[model samples]
Target: MMKYEEEYWIDYIKNNELNKKEASELLNLDIYSLMKIGDSLRSFDTGDTVSYAVSYNINYTNYCTASCPICAFYTPYKIKKYEINKPNKKGYELSLDDIKKDIEKAKALNVTEIHIVGGFNPDLSIEYYESLFKEVKKYLPDVTLKAFTIPEIDFISRTHGVSIKDLIQRLKEAGMDAHTGGGAEIFNENVRKLITTPEKISGEKWLEDAKLIHSLGIYGNSTMTYGHLENFDDIIDHMIRLRDNQIDTPGFLSFIPLKFSIENTPLYKMGKVRYPSSGDKDIKVYALARAILGKSIRNISVYWVALGKEMAQIALLSGGSDLVGTAFSEKVFGATNRKTSTSIEELNHLINEIGRIPALRDTFYNLKEYY
Candidate 1:
């Protein structure tokens, strides 16, 4: 980007008045200034440092239709024996029965929320999810069910030939409450083409679909997949797209800055996962996300899988509040977060160590029972 744009981002970050274009001067920031910006944003309003057992994701599946190249979860059309030093395996798609068993396990753990999202299961994870949600309510009525994305829904629609809105309504009626924004790696068409390509829905379509979901009253989180190939400009553009979209529908709950990892991903095979820091460009995006998203979004998630427990604890102090929920069974995000699953018990203790409450929250950020 032009040098002047970098200046604009610095001032806009500090002042919060400039439009997205002018404020994205961050694209031109020198290393030192960028670090300071990251530091400043890191210290911004992350509530209650004491760890609480607020929640963790109950990861439901490892199967998906869109095998985005940068993906961490799904395997090649067939199974692969690769387990990235973690317990995750890429080929096993959990069935509705498996999901039910997971829910039982999570309820036993006293988890307040179940953050369930699986890949585009052409084999009926859609109606399966409906059954899962209803069964969850039947068994553990208090536990919240915040599940899946509209894009996954879109995939199902194409696979099933139903309209997206109709799919959303069906899921909602069946017991899916909110959405957790995975799948939206970055929202720029050019960067997306350069990075994620065909496996993903385009940046514009993701937004359009997300907006429609919100209009339908399903609140959800949004995220960007960075650290692979795109630079700061692409990051800002993605943030701007979401920020602007939020002006229309505040239901866009939070903007997450996802770090890229090469573990078990096509990008890694291309050799894109190395950086000087313990993590890499993904960590940079985290600090940058804090600096940019600021308070417009209520929460920023640090997935234990990719960041690992130690780095994630550091992230809590660095402008991250939402520690992602526990996953009973997750092999996908496990690939990126770098862990198949982190128990709620472990996360609560970790956040406590770092002086942040592990506030268990539903997909909509509604606090759950602290267990």
Candidate 2:
């Protein structure tokens, strides 16, 4: 840990020479803290575990300029010579009527939140969402609408020559209630350039965007796209950056660890990239996040698309406190070659299997009860 970052608290945790919170002095935590948090959760679990809620990933467009190597969700994306080709989708954009049907289906299924996300579609604008969000709100105003990423906002701003600040404002005013934390690949530019680009805004930029949204009384989640070109130092640096951001604005409800899926992307084929630790690596990642972030961040979610439901259950026992996305009919994985979605009932069973109760919550972690 000292090799990664030099600090007294980090050294004390490595040496195991201090007491619990004493070692956590100045907000540096270690593996033992993770075990303590898990233990505390267990002690507090009164046979009343929180139920996982209904959420859906809304991919507005399949187009992207990022061309991230580990991504499986782009259309007409240029890939390397060695990677497998993804199936072609005739349509790149999800139509306004299609979005309406999705909303109707989500309402019929009683989804609490619609996680709207997609590529950096140049044609997509505030008007696109205005029509989509207005229709969704017309059908079901109660459902929380979680949408867009910092990069998406940036892309929209660049395409329409609007600032990201105003773009976010328009989206919020239109209907988006929260952010999805997608653009934050890694805070370090060197790592980002390998996957995304330096122009895509740094992790510090992501934190600023999150702060702006949180300042408006809206909440958003944060993420780390791990198991990619990043070194351990870069990965840890990303987490530390998010943690620092939380100190300023604590509205981030959870930290999602995005596992890199290598297929239909340039990095995997052309650059000869590999994700050696795919699923099992998350145990360490989640445990480390819980330890490092300590209790300041309430939930650490295991995204099932990246890690399957069974593995996510294992994560819950290890250190994870939330199941991310909670999506139905997720197209992100399909874009990546692993088309999969889980219903609320399946999520409930998964929570039970992991020895935790499934609690349905809105985009902001507000529990929505069924009377």
Candidate 3:
């Protein structure tokens, strides 16, 4: 294995050339040293200001076809289809009127972005999304609509017998601002197969679609769902893949290291995974992402909805430069029995408490205001 001194890695970060091997070595460093390197890199890239977005999350439906082992938010439609014959026990597919009302609520709060994601319902056609986006634009033409993950997009494309490029074009024409980076659990083929369902697309396809999205002039964020059955090597591989893709396309807005919430997940029930990521591992992942990705992907976001306020604060000092968003109705983490909502006021206070400047940003990381 390649060994390097602390100064060697530090210089590599300064030069914006930290390799995958050097990034992997950072995990072995003492926490303080690792954090110092990460903090320095973050400060150099983004300065002392920590950014966030005033956004709302709308999971249009919870009934899904791919009931991946890692997810607790999805209610399998096959199992619950019969329940629809009963009363209120079945899964939901939000109506267009319901979505319009949600958009109106977001507008009332002066939200800048509307984050839309949901389960891959085989029943919903591509026209459903097109109409949804079109109506959102009609209600709030200015609000940024950051919606759908690569997996959801892939599923929709295959279901409609259309190409991903074609699907994205139609959505963009309707009103999709950018794609979310969920569903990328771990890029390693073997590790991903073990964690997710077989129906889900591979990491290779995810990158290809992301590149295609970037080529079309729509930028988006990237994410990794860690703290599951993945090792240090798996983590490094995931970051490396994201970094390489950013180098090629350069449209990734940020990198979010989502700590796996295992409370209500299948892995937890099956006795395969027990706990959420410890605070130590959480900080290391965020910090290492800064060191590894370097200049390739600048923004490292700490998701407050998943990590809670305190750990999210700690992440700011470590390497995180953004607090993701003020998710008004975040359900994914809530389904896992974790806190899933934060306000603009609370986010500002958290960033200030950490002695960093707090700012509001648009979905594209454009600074709206600095507080």
Candidate maximizing lDDT: 3
Total clashing residue pairs per candidate? 29, 10, 0
Error of 2 at 29 (Å): 13
> Deviation in angstroms for 340 in model 2?
2.1
Error of 1 at 292 (Å): 2.4
Q: Residues 173-213, candidate 3, lDDT per residue (tens digit)?
A: 99998888778889999989878887788999989988987
Q: What would you estimate as the lDDT of candidate 2?
A: 0.67
lDDT of 1 by residue, 158-222 (tens): 88887878888888888777787777887767767766647567878888888888898888889
Report clash pairs, candidate 2.
50-357, 50-358, 50-359, 51-358, 51-359, 51-360, 52-358, 52-359, 72-335, 72-336
lDDT of candidates 1 onward, in order: 0.65, 0.67, 0.86
> Whole-model lDDT, candidate 3?
0.86
Ranking by TM-score: 3, 2, 1
Per-candidate TM-score against the hidden true structure:
0.81, 0.82, 0.96
- The regions of model 2 sitting more than 4 angstroms off are 1-51, 76-91, 276-280, 369-371
- The better-scoring model by lDDT among 2 and 3 is 3
